[model samples]
Target: MRIPIGRFTVPPEQPVVEEKTPSPSDKEAGVVSEQHPSDHESDNDAISSDAQAGVKKIEATTKVWSKSHLIAAYIGIWIIYFVDAMQQGTGTLLTPYVTSSFQEHSLTATTSVFSSLIGGISKLTLAKILDIWGRPQGYMITVLLMTVGLIMMAACQNVQTYAAAQVFYWVGYNGISYTLSVFIADTSSLKNRGFMLAFVSSPYIATVWITGPMAQSLLQGIGFRWGFGIFSIITPIMCLPLFFLFTYNYQKAKKQGLVVIEKSGRTFWQSVVHYFWEFDVICLILLSGGFALFLLPFSIYSYQAYGWRDPLTICLIIFGGLLLIGAFVWEAYFAPVQFLPWSLLRDRTVMGACCLAAILFVEYYIWNSYFTSWLQVVLNLNVTQTGYVSNIYSIGSCFFSFFVGIAIRWTGRFKWIAVYFGVPLTILSIGLLIHFRQPDTHLGYIIMCEIFYAFAGGALVICEQIAVMAAAAHQHVAVVLAMEGMFSSVGGAIGSSIAAGIWTGVFPVKLAEYLPAESQGDLASIYGDINVQLSYPIGSPTRTAIMDAYGEAQKWMLVGATAITGLAIICVVAWRDIKVKDFKQVKGLVA
Candidate 1:
């Protein structure tokens, strides 16, 4: 019907033309009524369908890398891990040799402090590097640093040189590990990520058994130089394939216009300035330095003339505490980019996972720091025997970690495994170890404790990784993972320091009390030289006294670890149950 308009003519209403449905023959000829009431709605429907199809096409293009590429990438990362495991296995055995060569038993604790501090710092640094420059660049830099560090260690002639070499090696080791973790997170779907990570760690199984015997042979027969030198060459070779694969894929993506590399269009110096600001170097310094200075005193107190009363120690503690406070403030309020995002603290899953990891490492290191020496002194085992015994824990860890990965994939739940299996088994193992930590305890019982502890500990590791990743946004995975690593490293440092303090303080005093009057004056020599202690005849009073003293110290350490493990169970229970989503689902949601 026609109606009167503001300025035009008013016309009488005419009979309305009703639209008729098209016949089948007319529909086949693409006929449509011009007067259809829903003409605009039909056009909108067609546009919506086209848009949905376009999204699907884009997703398919973005996910173009083949399964074979993923498999090759996994293998390449596994090779890097294998090399790292070899270093770890041999490094444990090298401690005594390094100490003896330097004529200082305290070097052991000092080196650990340096390694942990550098390693923690490297994790934070590498996280930024990977996020900014991409994974291939980060991986290459880590391998290069590690190779250089190994060469330095192989050629070192003094404790100072060895300590410096350790700094380099540990930093690179942490970087490599962190980068590989991020790569796994990027490639695997949430449901299968646990298994992929565990598979990467499978190198620990073979390296644990082989590196021990190899370390023993090298240290006893030839020397530590070759031990360090051989792996230096192997690491770079293993890393090459992964580097190439990443570069190839990145370039391919760029060529396809699927990814854009952002340029700041600044001069070289300006770019450097931007990168420094982007990496938040000031916060990095504050955090890393604070941790190092504060924790270093624990390792060095025994060597100080005044122990904890030393002015230097007091200064370090105060300064470190202040720097840590500053770091928190800057991260929370000032830094453009935070090394630790305050936002993550709001996530119960991230916090719980981080806490669980920190607690576990603290307990693990408390016993680990002195375990080999304890085995040697209390059990009268040689290097090879000690390696074999110590590695039982690792053997169990490898087997159980792999099993937990499969279970998580099957059940699609990680928290239950941690609560039901990890916590109780770990606590039980520690309790048994504490109970049996006596001079006359059976070796079989000790081995059993290690086996049980490792099995549960391995599962806990898997749980933490899965939990943290599951809770994080895909873009923040690297940073969150690195944050977890930093916490765990800090925990290791704290545990090592405490263990050092206890062992160094108590063992010397106990040894002095138990030694015969005639031999009492040689406490310094006895403490410095494991070989000198072993020279005492078997079953002699001197040997028995030293063994008893070690037993006492080890018992206390186990007690501390047991208490920490109990607390970790609380964290395990508190972790949130977040469902893992498949890659396609995540992508769709993001789109």
Candidate 2:
């Protein structure tokens, strides 16, 4: 039965069909192979056992869809990914302008640290929700959140409200992206899985080109509010088809008894309590609380007049460190459920992939946090040009990532390719950035480095993504992928914190050091606003001074980014050699 909501009809909920225990002969004949989730918390197949049968049904029949039906499904997935990417890409470009409008531009990286932590946890929660309730239900929830975020952003009166809205936006964004990955995983065999993922993620290529132009139009035309408002309306509509398709197929599978939902054989209250323990609520709380306390100081310290010496900042840093320690202690000893299963923790490949993913974010954000601002201020580029130059990374990465996918399929080896090829190229590109990122270097040389880094980074992304997915059985892929993403998001937050810390601490001093004595009094105003820096005429004394100061900061940032990225190379080199040719997909179980 469809639930009507004004003009739209919600997809029919799955009809509850109680599972039956199979007889001895049925078991002997291989009529069912149901593996239960661990009784305790896990990153394995640890959703409620009742959801397993439904999920099993999805895994089983996904490969059995008629060719046309499969095409339609693929089409829906592509549409969902494309629209979401379009919105996220354009919106990300508009964010600094919005922050600048509130005259609190310093808070940009700080707020992202908060949001990434929220988004990380939210990714895991939604993965669980989608795995249990059904994809459409999760999709609806995410879309609702994203729409709310967009609407709030459009209506926001201050920096605080806008930051609050970003949390919801990230949740929905991560959820939708997660769904897209799972959708591809559900359909593809290991043989072409890498290729399939790349094909679906191709939207980034378009968004790189399109969002720059679109953001420029919105920035110079009506305004960011209109842009946000328009996306609030369009995003949910664009997502409807994909979730509808997934729901229809899943419900159809259930109706035909292709699979069955199991009874947990527990009372309502017991099951509720069971899930709380099973989802590792305590662990999540500790992790979030601890990381927030630990990470926020990096960005917020500058806000305090006393800076690092402020009692509040010092207290928060200490408290945050203690909480992080508490989280580890709880996970290791007192918790019934834990964030990562010990088995996964022991898997070198998975850990290596996780580390590589995390470090990449740290590396990227170290320099990336302010490169666009550098472009506009030092290079005298406008918003559109700044956006275009910035997107050279996205453009090359997305396009060549598609190539990496096919290369992985053809070469049938990921570990060595990343270690030997992706790693070295990425290192070279970043090394080039150290020299060319300065104001004296021509812009074309800088673009070339970004392109080179993008190509290598693209390959590295696919390698790490597929490596994690390959390590886990299909049944656990959602959680595993979510976990890797969690690592990345947290790493990104930390990276943002480090960058923000360096920027806030160093940029002001550099500004003061470089400016003439007569201009010393204007240093605070100049440091606080990018607009003020850009207002100085090109080649003028003030502009030239700002360039030299900014170039100094950029030099240090790029050095830090380069040093951090070397860790990713170590991760790749230490990765267990898993070849695509040797992979097996049996009943969604990895081999």
Candidate 3:
């Protein structure tokens, strides 16, 4: 039987354009080609030049809607950013809610259910839809999904209902964001792509910074449902401007016959299969695995295990936003096609960079989630102190990641830098986590740890991003990026789940064993209560058990981070080196 591989294939060549010059008699057709010696392209170009030369076009004569249209575009982008930020920022919160709703659920069960429902199916389905439908249409469908899902979540009466709605909403929204990034890539020019993409990321930063206060205020004033209800209002409101931008772009492209996409006429399943067959497929798979491993544990740590002051969560989130924004800019402008490219995987220099980035991400999750909690819970610092100490990591990452891009450009040899600095730093940082696993660390010691890890990890991440894009062929860059994002998301989910499960399952069993016979009745009663309002406190056996469990969990994360980095090192080893030839030379070689 012949295999039916239905997938969109990358264009084999740029569209062949045939230039024609009109004869003098047919001058009305307007010769716009450079081959025509005349300065005038058309009566329209002449008129456009003449009108603008004499005077600044008066405001009254200019298009009135341009300003409105631009405003709408900005707002539309903000809305997308807002929802995206929340989906990520609120991930930790969601697991606990799911756990509570399903009383007998293990962390693995909850995470697996969530990953399959939200990450796996949602991403795959939405990706297909994005390919078939234009960005605007896909975005509209996403908005509809989120709106309906949020409404359902607000009204949810049980665990299964909530999970189903979350899956529906996440699939649409997540897919739309990925498609939007591709859309942004297409719309932007090379010179400004980096800055423009960074501009788009501003909302993620703003949301992280602002949502803490907003969530706290709402929770205090109205309660959980009302807080979510008020937040949900922002979703539909954000879509109004998107409606205008998407509609305008779609219509303009349609009129110009510029909206044509290469449709290979492959069946849907074939397309997915073809997607996986490409070398870019491995990047996606690995990155997703890394992300799931890291994020799953981190998400559950905040609420389920640590009960951190809310502001701390917010600050860490904002820091992540900043680092990601920097990464976005680096990916867009400096190394648009290199950072996560298939070509990069072929080059040892660039592969080292990509490996470094994955390792940095793992370090970021481990230090931010576990290390900070260790300082607060074990060291006994107040929330304010922990917040300040933790923010130090972000500060270090922000400064170094920005400069590292320029440094790579200055040095010209990224391979030497990555192998010498990045690989070692990653190994060392993981070592720090394992070595510094004391029961009660001092504040100054914690600050020193943050400064070292953040600076090294941050710089490595920036280099890796640049390396991936810088090494890839131009057309394959976007595919590489999409793969990177998929993995990052998956890693995060995995990290949070691992952390939560270790604490909840292992520690609880230990607690049952550790309690004295006389106090056992009291402990069992306390644990059994299960109500939000517990009458007992004072370092009860239950609380101690929870803390000890989490402390042990931290050790496991250190081991996992070290192991993952080891794999990254192997991937680096797999990478072969290629000389950096000019784009024209590279293109000729590929051809």
Candidate 4:
């Protein structure tokens, strides 16, 4: 006797007994056959053939709509990028003015802390929301949060309110960016994903140039309120098309039975409970609180009376560390549904890509935290000049990202690019930056360093994204990418905190050491006021001393950045050379 096993028919030893007979209802529902044994074998063969035909029909329908919907989705994505670039560029250029208005130079680091904390939490939250609820809902919530933040900032009368508003804005900004990346991953094959990401991001290059100058003019002319207010309106309008596109496609998918609506005959409260279980809300709270408590102390310690030795700081760090440990244990062994997929830990490529992203960001933000202020004080560049010089990085990022996208599309390889171009150029650029930190360094040299650093950094971004996506299973793409973003955000926060700590710890002391004894009393006043530091005449002893202190502090920061970039090279080297191919093919093999 022969028994069917998938496509093959296997011969069994001895006579095969007939299984239990189907009831009348089973026959009516087409679940089981009520026929002679020989007839039942033919019926089973026909059923299998019908199922295969149905699968092919569904695939044909999916291919047809996938192409059309993808084109519409890409158009919506481009519009979102245009609005996002304008908002980011304007906010970045206006940072100095915002901090100065609050009479705290260290507000730069403080704001970064706020952004990182909120951004990290938001990414973790939105990852679950996106994977569970779908992209359209996640996108709508992100835009709504950002709009509210912008409105609050525009209406803010105090520094407290402004800082509070930034929480919402950063969360929204990070969520929107992460959602867009997931969208690209969902629509494009691995072969073209890098190109698609770069193509969408290319708009930012042009937008940055315009918005940087525009932000300066807005701050100098109309004011910060109008700058924030105008974007609040533009963001929602630009994002509307995306909302419509996603909703339309989602409904269409449901109608086609491409998506099955999981229905549970549960009450509203039970539904909420189900969602909480699925999203692992407890783990999210523990993780977010733990990170905020531990990391935020570094940013604020310099302002405390006892600094790092403060009792409050000590308690925060201790409790935060404990909570983080608890969260890890829960996710690893106890949770029924784990948030962090521990299985990915065994995959060298995924972990390597994530670490590469995190380490590189840490390196970049070390010098980045104070580079603007360094230019103003040490190099004597005005706001407009500083904006132009600082924005050279964006110029480099824009062009290189576009070209790298094309390169990946053409060459079909990204690992060697990371090893040969991305890692080396970043190391070289940071080294040059350290060498050029002196007050007498030429403006051209600084600009060259910015260009080289940003261009190389752009290549790394493209490469890491491709590497991670290639290594992850298709269904897990969104969460895996979110994990990469989460690590990078945490790194940025840590880097900013470390940079602030070093600057605050060193700058005032260096200023005191460099200044004449008689003028040392003015140290507190100078730290409090940017204008006061700029008040001294050219080549004056006071101005020279301030510049010297800035140069020294920045040199240490760049040195730290250089070391981190070297570590990033090790991460790039350790990354597995996973070949980029269509995930559909990978899925086929697994199936």
Candidate 5:
């Protein structure tokens, strides 16, 4: 999906290449060979047929459009991104409130765990769909899922139903993000890829500031339900143009013989069976189920009447572990087609990128999952004030990443910057947070910590993204990138689970320990809603107890986050230092 630099003009007619999977009989049995062509194979080495098709597909789809089409596509993509970003920003504001209504505020992170698991994994599935059905089909499917989830969220009657809706929304959310990311990767050369990647997320800079106030107003006026309902209509509308452009261009590519369809002659049912095997559906199911079961316990086990002693909790955790093991065994020994490109599994740079992203996400989510509530309750901030403080990490990340992207463009490098600044900043942020996240700390101090973490988080995210993509050629971009996103999101799921375990387990105990003896009877109410905690005046016994409880519970989570982030440095050092100099050099990956 390479476009001409600056102009984005369509390429010349390409040769027809039939789409199909690599055969088990051949060495390139998966979607890609286990070794990179440049790494192990000489220039004269014969490329496999499936590799040729893949390469050709990438070339053909690099098809761009006229000036007007380009403008429309560029605008459409950004607009859709803006709408989605706005929706998410507001949704985050409302989720705690929704949980409070159900008297399940403590379960907020638990709900997010399910969503992150589903959404993160959906990237792998969407990548496969893009490979088989084309980009437009995958994009439209995600849009549909997103709209349905939005509608369900507005209408959901209970926490269980809302959790299901959250899962649906997250799947679509990850899918949309994945599609947009692939779009950027498909169009830009490696030299400018870093900048482009950061540029797209620039919407967050504005949305972050606006969403809090906007959501606050909406909550006061029409309510959270209407907010979700309005967005359900708006997001899909913004998506229409991009969907049309991809579909139109794809059909035109097909007509020009630049894109060839598979001609496997089989009945419809047989074809379905073939794709099931080709996609390794059973493997995906096992993987998803394993993660869901294993992670669910950490988030929900404390809520059970029997707690950790519950037989159901023990069985679920054991079965989940077994299922995960089964998935690994299957992927390693028996799957016909692997989810990630085979060579990606062997690429040190790619693995390092995935590991780095996973580590960052794990650390970020562990402390961040319940951070807003912490700010509101402990600092005595309103919803809008909490939003202002909460947005600093993300806004700063986007703000810093844009400049870092430009730095990457000029330097033709990223690894050194990440090691020197990103890692150190992360360590510093944690160190500051240890002090600032305490009871009655000045609000400015907390913001300072967030700013540091924001820079570290953004830099690491951009570096890993560029590192992973730079290691792969055009043909393997979607698969490798999807794998990275999958790992990152899975890490987030794990972090959310840990946070849930800590917050639910430690927070209530702390509350019980610190609250006045007479107030013990109201423990459940205070534990479930920050609003109730906020009702008591500052410096009062009850308020003091609440603040002390919040501080003690989160102190351990911050320490754990900092401890986990140390692994990020190892990931940075392990990467293969590839310089992005020109699109033609090393097929636009390495200089």
Candidate 6:
């Protein structure tokens, strides 16, 4: 009987005529079906086993880098950072020689132009080069640029020639600095990024501190050619290991198909535009601008205006640099961004942070470039001892940076920190500088002032970074950072130029005024040996008396710092009461 189920009824006689099934040996042999629960269970087990085996194979075949490799990468980054420091530190030593040999400050300006070109211009151009050519090639190219620059510097006789050399030097400098940062970011996980970053920074600090005195010693003893030549040789040797490191990384990336750009799309314009819209690019510009602005008066004026011959100036600059770096990270991670669809700089908090950073950096630069030089020029400290004493700023900055980080974490608001610690210390630093007029004033007082300034500067740096980041929504952090750098650089360049103009303009007029009218023209010859003013026995009384006339120039620097910092306070005030925006809700606007 047939059983009927639903729509159609089964016919009772449908299977009455049964046909014979085909034999197994036949071409159309029938297949057998296994219906046992055990067969299904066994098949499932086999599939699971195959998956586990695949996972095991992956675990076993995947290469985990050795500790030695990790250490090598770390050290390699450190060396890259170290080279940039050495360039700056050694350049500080070479400045006097370059100025004297060229007999023109304009040549020095040319060198500055070259330096800026490599740093700002090249960074824009090379970003794409890195993407297309890969990081290894970019790194190697940078090493070559640096090597060529140093070699040219060693061989320079004229100002133009030396300035030309700076182009190459700066190219190398920007290349390595930018590429290494990219490499680190690519290789490290987010959790350990902070430590790795710190590892890179530590070398910068350590090298800067040591390079100054060492560079100075080399300049004084073996002369500039050999001193700078050594760097040329060392740069390539130091970069050799990087060749292997970068190659390994590139090969790995190739295998993974991680390279984004191809050689066909490579062009200077394309490279620049590639990074223009990137968040990190903006951040780099902003931070660099802040740094540049801070550096302006000091970098341009210290050697010429105050006749500073101390290495400590550089050390102090690095102190602030390291502190601000930490502050930047905290800000970028924690702060919000504004104008999410466009720019990152419109955020008030970030603007305030930039302002404060600008203030502190400018103040620090003044001391680094001018005060120490004034101490030696006006107070007459010997070179050896003065270099050691320059560490006062470093001592103060290092101590305070640690404290400021804690203060921000403890207190949610950054306003009080800016007002209470930031502005007051900056004002007081200027005050201390103004009062530091007496030739016989104790060095201890100066050191104390520097310490105080460093403390204040540290607080300001942290506050500004936090505020700026807070001001912007999260998506624009990198853009804000780049803007900060660009502004800082412009500010610094202008400040330094002003300082140079002031010194070159003032010193000669004062010297001329104190000299006899007939001897005024002849006194110009004595400018190369400005120490003659301190030691009348070495030259003439007219130069000494003329130098004495400008005993008040040092005090003017204090007034300038005070004025700049006052402007900074106004920026700080403007920065207050701004609300930070949340970026997560606007993620589509970000990219």
> Which predicted model would earn the best TM-score?
5
Candidates in order, TM-scores: namely: 0.86, 0.88, 0.60, 0.85, 0.92, 0.63
Ranking by TM-score: 5, 2, 1, 4, 6, 3
lDDT of 2 by residue, 449-533 (tens): 9988989988998899888776666556666677788888888888889888888877777888888777788887777677777
lDDT of 1 by residue, 103-145 (tens): 7764566677757766876686786666555667778898898
TM-score of 1: 0.86
Candidate 5 ranges beyond 4 A from true positions: 1-4, 7-12, 17-58, 260-262, 340-342, 585-591
Whichever of 3 and 6 has more lDDT, that candidate is 6
Q: Compare candidates 1 and 3 on TM-score and give the better one.
A: 1
The sequence of per-residue lDDT tens digits that candidate 5 reaches over residues 43-106 is 3212223344434443454453444555456567767778888899889888888888788899
lDDT of 1: 0.72
For model 3, the superposed segments whose C-alpha errors exceed 4 Å read 1-79, 90-109, 116-132, 159-162, 169-173, 187-209, 218-221, 239-243, 257-401, 404-423, 435-439, 443-475, 493-497, 513-519, 522-545, 572-591
Q: List the residue pairs that clash in candidate 2.
A: none
Clashing pairs for model 5 are none
- Report the number of the highest-lDDT candidate: 5
lDDT of 6 by residue, 310-349 (tens): 4454544565466457437634563232112223344455
| lDDT, candidate 4, 1-591, per-residue tens | 111111122212111111121111111111111121222243221111222121222222223244445566677788788888878777876766676677776667667765676676567568666654566668789999899989988888766777778878988888898988877775565667777787778777777567757876896789988999999999999998877766665455456444343344667776677667666788887887888788778767878889999999888899989889999999877776777766664566677888888888787778888777777788888766777777777767767987887687677678889999998999999999888978889998998888898899889999998877776644456667887888888888778877887788788888988997777888887775576777876598998899898888888989998988788777778776655542231110010
lDDT for model 4: 0.71
**Model 3 Cα lDDT, one tens digit per residue, 1-591:** 111111222222222111111111111112111122232233221112211111111111111224344445545675677666654444333333344444522332344334432453244334333432334555677777776766666677666676666665665465556555545443332222323344454454444444444444443465445544654687777666766655664454334332223445667676566444422344334333433333433344434434334555445545545544554454445532223333324455444544444454544454344444444445554333544454555456555654554454355434454566656676776667666665544556656766776666555554454344444433333344444444544444444455454545454465467555655665444332222112224266544553454456677767777776766665555433322222210111010
Q: What is the lDDT of candidate 2?
A: 0.73
The 10-residue segment of model 5 with minimum total lDDT is 582-591
Tell me the spans in candidate 4 whose CA falls farther than 4 Å from its real position.
1-69, 260-262, 516-521, 581-591
The CA root-mean-square deviation of candidate 4, after full C-alpha superposition on the true structure, stands at 10.5
Cα lDDT of all candidates, in order?
Answer: 0.72, 0.73, 0.45, 0.71, 0.78, 0.50
